[model samples]
Target: MSVTTTSRMRHLLTYAAFVAPAVLFFTMVILVPFMRAILFSFQDWNGISSDIRWAGWSNYTKMMSDTGFLKSFSFTIKYVLATTILLNVVGLLLALVLNLALKTRDFLRTAFFLPYVIGPVIIGFIWQFIITRLFSEVGKATGWVLFQKNWLSLPDYAFWSLIIVTIWHSAGYFMVIYLAALQGVPKDMLEAAEMDGAGRLKRFWHVVLPLIRPAMTINLFLAISSGFKGFDLNFALTKGGPFGTTESLAYHIYLDAFTKNLFTYASAKAVLFFLVLASITLVQVAVMKRREVEM
Candidate 1:
């Protein structure tokens, strides 16, 4: 009833008002689904059946013995590594180029980032058509053998094609991140390096890289996570085709739950996939944080 108590009550009400909507939404969507997924991982739910019987660790045991799942898991790791490295490298290069004084830098930045604005499903369809149709035509016209083979039909080619498309789509977005970080570098330090006879490459290697380590950390994390969890583009482009060689873990999870109606087994795979991602991300963050502190 006093002035302090009334002010405290009003602040509490304001906090509740802001937090209530998000809490309700999270419970309805993320928290509920996550809890249900954990339960389903231990059951024998066929995704459509009314009877759900607890099967203990049968799903996890089966997952370990499943050759297809193992193959997909391996493929996912390869994709993640390839895509992460390429995305970061290409993004950094683009950012460096754009950092130079150029009349078309803004235009180029928009052009590069435009692909990322498109939905992944749409990008997949566009790239699928280009690889299938345009590449063959261009090859015929130019006598180039770049598109001689069916890009989406061959396993190795399809895998690399997906990687290329993913990099093309994502590099620009990361470039923007790197560009912001690059702009934040102390210009006086760069000027000092130049005065000290540090050539461009030397400057980048010694001065620029250490200063941009924070951006590198963030960019690497995003690229790795996105690469590991990539699904829609693969679905549209390869659909785990050419004898299932292109099947990623995410696609495998979708297939198990939706296509095969093995919800419980899919849930187990999802849980395992989440743990793998978490472990890798945590290690990466710790290493990067240590490096940042050293810098």
Candidate 2:
């Protein structure tokens, strides 16, 4: 009844008008499904059938003995490590080069980033054709021993092939992030470092790196998460081939849920996957945040 109460009520309604849609969207799309998945992880159900059964801890316990699941997890960890390191290194290098004032700088940036615009599935298919078809043709024409080898048919090669494709697809994205960070580094700082008798490498190591720590944190986080959740390329390119050496955890989860019809078991694996990813990323952010320079 009072003017103060009426004004407060109006402000609350205005705030709710802006926030309500996002809250509802998150609840329906993410929160609800997440809770449902937790519930499903405790029950056995064919994805299509109505005959659901309570599974308790059986699904989670079974993972301890599942060799294929274990292998996929191991492979995923390796994939994450390889991709994260290579993506960051290659991306940073590309960023450094592209950041330079070259004549074709803008054009080169666009060319490099063009791959990231394509979907992983499409990139996989494209590279699949290139590796399997075009490479062989080129090899025969040029007598190139390197191209003659079947990159996708051998276990080690297949693993590296996946890493190569992942880096090709994503490196430009990471490069853009690093480029922005690099550009943000003060020119005066570099000049000051030079004036202090620091060489190029020393200047970059001491001045540039410390300044770009925020971007490094962001790029590292993206690389780790993207590496862990890698599936589309695995599905479209190799399909976990060459004795399943390149089967990522996400792909394995897909196999269990869709191919094996072990929905509850897959849900359990997904839950564990979430926990592991969350823990690793949290630790990464915490550690990186500590090292980040305020400037």
Clashes (backbone N, CA, C under 3 Å), per candidate, total: 0, 0
What TM-score do all the candidates reach, one by one?
0.98, 0.96
The TM-score obtained by model 2 is 0.96
Q: What's model 2's overall lDDT?
A: 0.93
lDDT of all predictions: 0.93, 0.93
lDDT of 1 by residue, 7-126 (tens): 999999999999999999999999999888988999998999799999999999998889999999999999999998999999999999999999999999999999999998999999
How high a TM-score does candidate 1 get? 0.98
Give the alpha carbon lDDT tens digit for every residue of 1-295 in model 2: 9999999999999999999999999999999988888999999998889999999998899999999999999999999999999999999999999989999999989999999999999999999999999989999999999889899999998998899999999999999999999999999999998999999999999899998999999999999999999999999999999888889999999998999898888999999899999999999999999877354
Candidate 2 Cα RMSD after full superposition onto the native fold (Å):
1.4
RMSD, each candidate, Å?
0.9, 1.4
- Please list the residue runs of candidate 1 whose C-alpha ends up more than 4 Å from where it truly belongs after superposition: none
Window of ten residues with lowest summed lDDT in model 1: 143-152
